[model samples]
Target: MATYTINVNGKKREVDADPDTPLLWVLRDHLGLVGTKYGCGVASCGACTIHLDGSAVRSCSVPVGAIENQKITSIEGLSEKGDHPVQLAWKEHDVPQCGYCQAGQIMSASALLKKNANPTDDEIMGAMAGNICRCGTYNRINAAIKTAVKNS
Candidate 1:
């Protein structure tokens, strides 16, 4: 085991873990930030999506040792009061059915918006392509993205 300090949610967090430990486990198991969930355990599912240096990434496949000193933002850090524009838009659109993939969805959407304050529909679709919603709420997700853009 080795000690590594990483910046998460704008705070420096220290954890002792193996080099190859997935960042998902480091956040959920070591740091007790369970907001980032484990879905497929592979990078295919976006349930473990989080922001690494302002870009959305699948945490399940990212080793903790690889991200030292980088800024990591999980769902919990998206907003202080759970009222981020995307989150509010999500609620407004009622996007989640199962809600298992919503966090990742939100993270991906937020990252897209951050990079492009006004993304076209095609752009939005491209950005969210990697995230899969089992409940198949793509329409609502798209609506929420548009709403978030308007609110932003």
Candidate 2:
């Protein structure tokens, strides 16, 4: 085991874990940040999405030791009061069904908007295609992303 210092939600956090531990476990277990969910253990699903150094990343596929000095932003840290534009849009559009995938959905949408504030329909779909919602809320998710774009 080894210790790695990482910046999470604008705060410095240190964790001692195996070098190969996925950032998902580190965030949820080590740092007590469980907003980042565990969907597929592999990187196929985007349920473990997070922002690593301002870029959307699959935390489940990112090794803890490889993320030292990077800034990590989980769903809990997406906004001060869960009021980020994407979050507001999600709520306004009623995007969650089981709510298990909403956190990753929001994180991905937020990242998409960060890069393309005025993304077209194709862009929105392409950006969010990787994050699957088993409840089949694709239309609502798309609408919410567009709403977030408008609201922002």
Candidate 3:
């Protein structure tokens, strides 16, 4: 095992893990940050999405050792009080159904908004295409993103 220091949620965190271990496991198993869920062990699913250096990434596919010095932001760190505009919009629009994919969806939306404050419908769909909601809440998700844009 190798030791690595990573910046997660603006905090410096140290963990000892194998070089091939995915960042998802490090955050959930090692750091006890379970907001980033594990849907597919591969990178196909966005369930393990997190922000790495201001870009949304799939933590399930990102190796811990390769993420040193990068800033990681999970759903828990998005807002201390859970009042981020996107989160608020999420609540206002009632976007969640099963709630399994909401965290990743929120993370992806927040990242997209960070880059583009006023994204068009196409842009919103394109940015959130990677995340899948089994409950098929696409319409609500799209509405929530629009609300977040207006609210923010």
Candidate 4:
């Protein structure tokens, strides 16, 4: 194992792990940042999503070593009080059934809004396609994105 330092949620964090250890494991195991959930253990599911350099990334597929010195943002760092517009919109819309995928879903939506303040429905769907909500709350997810935009 090697020691690597990375910027997470604006703070410098150091972890000792194997170079191939996925960012998801590093965040959960080493950093104790469990908000970024583990699912599928691959890049297909968005459950391990996090912001890498301001863009949504699948932490499960990213190695901690590859991200050294890069900025990382987990769900916990999205806002100090969990009051980000997208978060508020998620709550306002009551968007989650099992709630396991919401963090990644929110992260993706937040990233999308950061790029396009007023994204079209197609854009929203296209951006969120990678995130899978087993509860099938796609309609609510879409509504929350629009609400988050309006509330922005």
Clashes per prediction? 0, 0, 0, 0
Against the true structure, candidate 4 has what lDDT? 0.94
Per-residue lDDT for 15-118 in model 1, tens only?
A: 99999999999999999999898999989979999999999999999999899678999999999999999999999999989899999999999999999999
lDDT (tens digit, per residue) of candidate 2 on 85-142: 9999898999899999888888999998998999998998888889999999999999
Give the number of the best model, judged by lDDT. 1
Q: TM-score of each candidate?
A: 0.98, 0.98, 0.98, 0.98
> Runs in model 2 with CA error above 4 Å?
none
Task: Give the Å shift of residue 35 in candidate 3.
Answer: 0.5
Error of 3 at 128 (Å): 0.6
lDDT of 4 by residue, 1-152 (tens): 99998899999988899999999999999999999998898699899999998999999999987995679999999999999999999999899999999999999999999999999999999999999989999999999999999999
The TM-score of predicted model 4 comes to 0.98
Per-model lDDT: 0.96, 0.91, 0.94, 0.94
Any idea how many clashes model 1 has?
0
RMSD of each: 0.6, 0.7, 0.6, 0.6
Worst 10-residue lDDT window, candidate 3: 40-49
After superposition, the stretches of candidate 3 with alpha carbons farther than 4 Å from their true spots are none
Query: Could you tell me the lDDT of residue 102 within candidate 2?
Result: 85
